[model samples]
Target: MGTITQFHLAFPVRDLDEARHFYGEVIGCPQGRSDTSYQDFDFFGHHLVAHISGEGRPLQSGRFDGEAVPIPHFGMNLDRASWEALATRLKAAMVAFHEEPHLRLKGKPGQHVTMFLFDPSGNALEFKSFDDPEQTFIP
Candidate 1:
């Protein structure tokens, strides 16, 4: 197999401490170096940094596969079991889901499990997993 690369993402947050709780505790992201202004998180295998962008940010949505998806959302792909565990955690936390968890492309080439939710900062995130990992890139 070829080398896999991790990506870095920096997004807005209303409060640093709240961001810390959401990303660190809620989402299970391990906390990294942080200052008063920004903090980095281990987002599954990616680098995610949250910056204090103040309050009352607008949320946008788009349609995908007949479902309303959060515009400009970020997330990761996991195996089925990991995805379910995270889903349970999010539900136990009473995290408000923009779109409840469901299956998409059912009985098709790219069938998968997906769910969407937002952080306290209002940034959207979608976590999904495919029945067959190899179908991920299929058209």
Candidate 2:
């Protein structure tokens, strides 16, 4: 009923080993019990799974607020200060963004700042923050 407490997401990846390296090694997500067909990751604080889909596949993305944004993606909401700090941290870490940190609904209601990133498994994760947290559920 608040900022999402936790979530579970599964994405397709061509190689389990590569996915393991990326999620578990590069991004520094904690590893979880898994099998050959799939692997689980303790993402920040959520449960994320990567399954062996196939090879040579690319996820289609679109544009949002002057930046290329990923479709069919999922992410979490953070408090304004946390979101700002995360955007700063991602930039400092040289993390590539499908959409740079900026308010999405420019010239409209619920104009919240957000950013998007891709995992090695080709899943999109958006981190969003709102100036007025109460506006979060406004119509």
Candidate 3:
């Protein structure tokens, strides 16, 4: 594998203060640059900008491995230890889970653990871990 590059994503949010609290305090992302219209966060080594739009759309669900998962979500693929730690932190923060953390595709290739949740702005996020990291991109 070659060098991995960081990703940048800009999404709309209703309030900047709420975004800061959720991403900074609850999710544990370090705050970066910011202004009246937007705020940046170090989201799991990726660039995440929350722009003030004062509105957000409802999330739709999609089928995945016999489970309903929130569509148009964004998240990181972590190791099992980190994934579990984050899950515990989120639970302690009282954040509701869109899909509880659980294993999927048992005894099969690409089997992994996954969980889903939403931000204060209603943007869905997923965090998962693969049994075999090498199988991440395997079909």
Candidate 4:
């Protein structure tokens, strides 16, 4: 409704070069400021920083709408075109999907197209889109 604010998230990674390649090359995020220990990216307009923290932690899972989704995932709500294009790009890059691209909640108020995947560091990410953007927050 008003000016949407951008988000900033910093997470750990096993290696920096791996992260740079994945975020910059695979995900198509523009690289930002960085040093040896940390780097930043324009993650779908959000400020996402990957910090060097070896291996990080084991991922957990939770059931959502009959699907077992990664417990601690982060991602964006994109437009349909962008969501589909990214899905295609990830597939072409051979990124293993946590949840393959598909429609969810069909005919429901919250129907959406979504896909899930992990970065090289094993941090899970989800990207979704809705025909009606307001469906993103509907009850």
Clash count for each candidate, listed in order shown: 0, 0, 0, 0
Tens digits of per-residue lDDT for model 4, 1-139: 2233334455667788999999989999888656666666877767566767656664255444567666556777677777778888899999899889999878977578888888989878878776676544343
RMSD values for the candidates in order, in angstroms, are 12.0, 11.6, 12.3, 12.1
Clash pairs detected, candidate 3: none
Report clash pairs, candidate 2.
none
Question: How does each model score on TM-score?
Answer: 0.58, 0.52, 0.58, 0.58
Model 1 earns a TM-score of: 0.58
Name the lDDT of candidate 2.
0.68
lDDT of each: 0.71, 0.68, 0.72, 0.71
Candidate 2 local lDDT, 1-139, one digit each (tens):
2344345455667788999899989999877646656676878877566666655565344333355445446776677777777888899999988778878867655467888788888778888765665444333
Better of 2 and 4 by lDDT: 4
State the lDDT at 10 in candidate 2: 54
What TM-score does prediction 4 earn? 0.58
Candidate 3: TM-score? 0.58
